[model samples]
Target: MYSPVQPMHIPDGFLSTLVSIVFWVISIVVLGYALKRVGKDLGERQMPLMGVLAAAIFAGQMLNFSVAGGTSGHLLGATLATILLGPWAAMIVMTSVASIQALIFQDGGLLALGANLFNMAVIGVMVSYFTYTSVQKLARGKAWGIFTGGALAAWTSIVIASLAAALQLALSGTSPANIAVPAMGGIHMIIGLGEGLITFGALAFLYATRRDLFHVGEAAPKGSKAIWVGGLAIAALLAVLSPLASTHPDGLEWVAGQKGFLEAARAPLYNLVPNYVFPGISNGSLATIVAGIIGVVLVFAVALGVAYLRRGRKRSK
Candidate 1:
């Protein structure tokens, strides 16, 4: 059976029709609010950063690291996105990214788009933002506190997303809560470790490189050369290391297999690039690398287009 590498991107036929519709409605509403909230802080200067960061996020998701116990997990980047672009923008960026993954890449079910977006975008970003801010305040601005807060928030977001996915499955009668919860929660508990560490390390890099960055309404550092170089480096790394990613099923896939629902997944709306496989590419590794690059470029363009349009609207107003 086929499997996805991303977390909580529940394919079609897994969720009840009602559950899917509810999530879609909920996600759309949240996204509307997210746009308005983000508009307040997304100055023109921040637009380009969103595109580049979106690219980085897209690339990052392609590289799944092992979580041990025969499971794997990729970066959620929701918490990290919150740190970079703030919660609102992160939500928008993440949702857009997830949507593209579903539509063009065929990585997720179109009917299930709403649920996946809700779990990864709304829940992940919103919960992580609150957790990070609270921890930062409680820690009183120390580097350790701030960094630790990021780590905690990253881990929390992953765990919560996992639980939400489990809840969706349970509500759909796909699996028992007792079975889904522990399996998802336990596996993700370990997956969350990498999420936290990566989040903290990225934050530390930013702090060391540009302290004024990530503040509300603040633009990226004026010395942007380093940022560009870093972003490119990350994108390149994702392209290179992705094919080397653990072939083991990710946490969600592993759980589904154990729970016997892995076979329930259905074809996406379109398979333009099924499994992130690029058309006309026979070689598996090369296809994945090409697909990774394409995803980055596509994500960058989408983010830039949105930011550009948002700026245009503001100017018109």
Candidate 2:
């Protein structure tokens, strides 16, 4: 039984055209604001940081850990990005990741991309930012406070994202609200624990080693070659480990399956690295690694390009 690498994203037919169009409008407005905000104060060092963060998130998404009841989940990375890059820049990075996943990897449906962007990039990132900030204020910025904030923020983001997706499915009449909400929301609660732990551990590591990275969003330090190199190295390492990711259905897929809407998923318009396997690669593990590495590079390039283009626009004004 060969399972496609479907993450927590809605496929094409799952969303009605009207619903999809509405989300597209909303996503466009929000992302346009994000671009404007980032452009206004984009720094030289921030370019590489954006690229590195995008690459890291892309690679991290490849390693899906299994949750209970035959479901799987991966790091949404919205909270991590928001904490490190601010909400605006984090939105850019997350949109890049989601776009690449849909257009290149075919992980999600093209028609449903707007909804995905809204769910993960906008709602998830915003929820994470506010939750973390509230916790940080309560703890007075202590190490324990930051770590707690990151964990809680990450968990809440995932749950909220799932709820948004569930609402979309219900509104589309793909699944009833009674079934969709509970099924989508319940399993994700367990899945969110994994996200929370990963986020907490990541924050703890950074707090121990590179406390200055936290300041990159406010006044980024001058570009450091070592940081970029180290960042890429970490992404590459995650790609190398992508082969070991669990093959179970993610929250969305599992809910779709249980609710009898899994068959509504449509094939992508095109295939670049379909299902995270490189072309002409017989070995499954090797092919996944190759595909993952390529995804990392592509995401890095896109993020850097966006950063530079925005900076250029700001200078021209």
TM-score of each: 0.64, 0.66
Q: Against the hidden true structure, what lDDT does model 2 obtain? A: 0.74
What is the C-alpha lDDT profile of model 1 across 173-229, one tens digit per residue? Answer: 676665776677677788899889888888899899998875733443332333234
Which regions of candidate 1 deviate over 4 angstroms? 1-4, 63-73, 216-317
Worst 10 residues of 1 by lDDT: 240-249
**Candidate No. with top TM-score:** 2
Task: Looking at model 2, report the run of 10 residues with the lowest lDDT sum.
Answer: 240-249
TM-score of 1: 0.64
Clash count of each predicted structure:
0, 0
Task: Give the per-residue lDDT digits (tens) of candidate 2, residues 1-317.
Answer: 22336446888899977678889999998789778777776777778889888989988866676766787666779999988887788889999988988888777789899999987888777777767766876887677878998899898777767767866776666776657666776777777898899898889999899999776335432232332342234334322321221122143344444643333444343354465464567678887898999999999999999999999999999
